[model samples]
Target: MPDPRTHLVGPAAEAEIRRLTRRSLLVGGVATAVGAGALAALRYGPDEAGIPWFLRRVLEGNERLARATFSNRLAPEFPRARAAIPRVNGRYGMAETTDSASWTITLVRPDRHDAVLTLPALYGLPRSEMITELKCVEGWSEVVAWGGVRFSDFAAKFGPAPGQFDYVALATPDGGYYVGLDAASALHPQTLLCDTLNGEPLPAEHGGPLRLVIPVKYGVKNIKQIGRIEFTRKRPADYWAERGYDWYLGL
Candidate 1:
């Protein structure tokens, strides 16, 4: 099978590139007329170059707002049909090999206290219900039935109230991939530190030991192979955002 990370970037990047190309062309035409007697390149000027960048960010901002305003609605799935879900994509913060038995989740509190929660600890929490749309940045989506502990419960087990923190950052075991979530999305009614997908344990390739199920944001924000969850006031670094993607690819 092809690498899953490839699937995540192509469509979104292509669409943005095309949008930018058009603006570049239009701006080049205008620049040629203004600097006709001069020798500036016919490529996009600063004004034209700004179009796609601004639009892409604007698109990202729109997604964030939509998610924030989104009602905690569930996505419906069939009672009997089973879909062979795709293998996990993207592997920042995840190792090529992982051992779940040895995995641990760390909760960093505002008071500088640290609490460690294991996989079993998560399952021990009251299993919350969620059936939400997992919108991929690739533009496809699936409504999945997820059963796991509420992020709020996960935090409460350690320290600090759910709503007290400004941000929640999660990373894969390898620490190569990471994502941050705002307080509202972290504590959203539909957010879950999910262990089960489609009523079964998540496969090792699909963030096995633990993964986040955040309904308010796109799938990229639902960092898989979750190794740790830390509460902080600082904006967390995201793997995809550094690659020219939107930092806030919500909804």
Candidate 2:
């Protein structure tokens, strides 16, 4: 009911006031929940890198969306002439002391005994080459030429084939960085166990000798200096996942 004396703030103005008041309350409640949940996460979550449970829920929802929406369409390829060197994403697994000559990758397959493969052995396999874009989570991208072995071919020869596993995981020798993948993406035709970049032997800065080049995922999922591979029926733990990043990390 409007008072005739308060005509200046009659129906429209009162309606606006009520709307703003409700919006303020809603915003305040959301902020309060976020703050409280963050505190709770800090006290009980995995580590300070962890976010609020509600945020995790949101990330999980995003993962679900990605799983539903993303396709296995081959990432577009460029002519080798257009390829350029990509910036080094990180060297978490590649230490200054790393000895590529002696590097060996451990493989753990669900259906077979664990095996160790020397880095040279991986390079000698039937070779594959591609010129494609590498997209980073930092909102940058580059077209690069890569030469290596197809992940599917490597798996079919040495480990479980694509459909044999529900998941795959890769890690660096020093255990500093790791990533998990769904089997589908792991065996995508564009996914490679690359050792060459832009027509040159891969430089140490770019995960030389061996690294994953998965065009279907953000660069984070294309782990560097892979020293271990696992084919599993379980969703293996991931380094960024513990730090509040989306586990799937799809493109």
Candidate 3:
């Protein structure tokens, strides 16, 4: 035999291998410890609205970023030819098949008296229309033509109630579903109290008769079958926000 250990590692090579293995184990142990600590911190951190405190801070930071860059330039309008009917994705307050005749919107402001207005009254303010994309938080969107009065116009005619810092809360008549909007967004010219979709009367399945069409925010904020509206200086409770979703989810 040329050498019995020819195929084997020499003593020096084996020593080097041991050293490398030990170094790798040491590095891996440190990494595992750091990773476990991080996981523990995330799990043990204080909770805000069911979100970890650090994560809520991140959400707050994103909200501030969105506000700092806020602009009136919204998504481009799609032509009527391109408008498509959006899929009905939610049914929180639309379960009841109430007659359209009974539909009324209750408007409230901190200082102003609450006013309940009929659909015809809203139409009386000023008829407006637009074709825009209704983007949902679930990563789907549709180009739909909308008809109603611009929320800005409605607010101007109602009582000019909202301020920059105020919030606008909207809900179905049953209050089973609700969403809050920053006054700035509620006053956007594109926001509308929609009654028609794709040139047809809104369907009940889609929160027909009267719904909110806020093109700037995700569809979650575009409440359907709005039965109540309130303008308040205090931030109102939001449905998705309470469930740990981004509250200020803007497009």
Model 2, 1-251: lDDT tens digits are 87654464668788877887999999999999999987786567654337656667777799888777767788899987788888876777676645678888999998889999997776557898899999998899999999899998888888775577988999988889999998878888889999888878777778877889999899999887889999999998998888778788887
The C-alpha local distance difference test score for the whole of candidate 3 amounts to 0.84
TM-score per model over all chains: 0.70, 0.77, 0.84
Q: What's the number of clashes in each of the models?
A: 5, 0, 0
lDDT of 1 at 117: 68
* Candidate 2 weakest ten by summed lDDT: 45-54
Which one is best on TM-score? 3
Q: What is the TM-score (0 to 1) of candidate 3? A: 0.84
Model 1 scores a TM of: 0.70
lDDT of each: 0.71, 0.84, 0.84
Model 1: colliding residue pairs: 92-176, 92-177, 93-175, 93-176, 93-177
Give the number of colliding residue pairs in candidate 2: 0
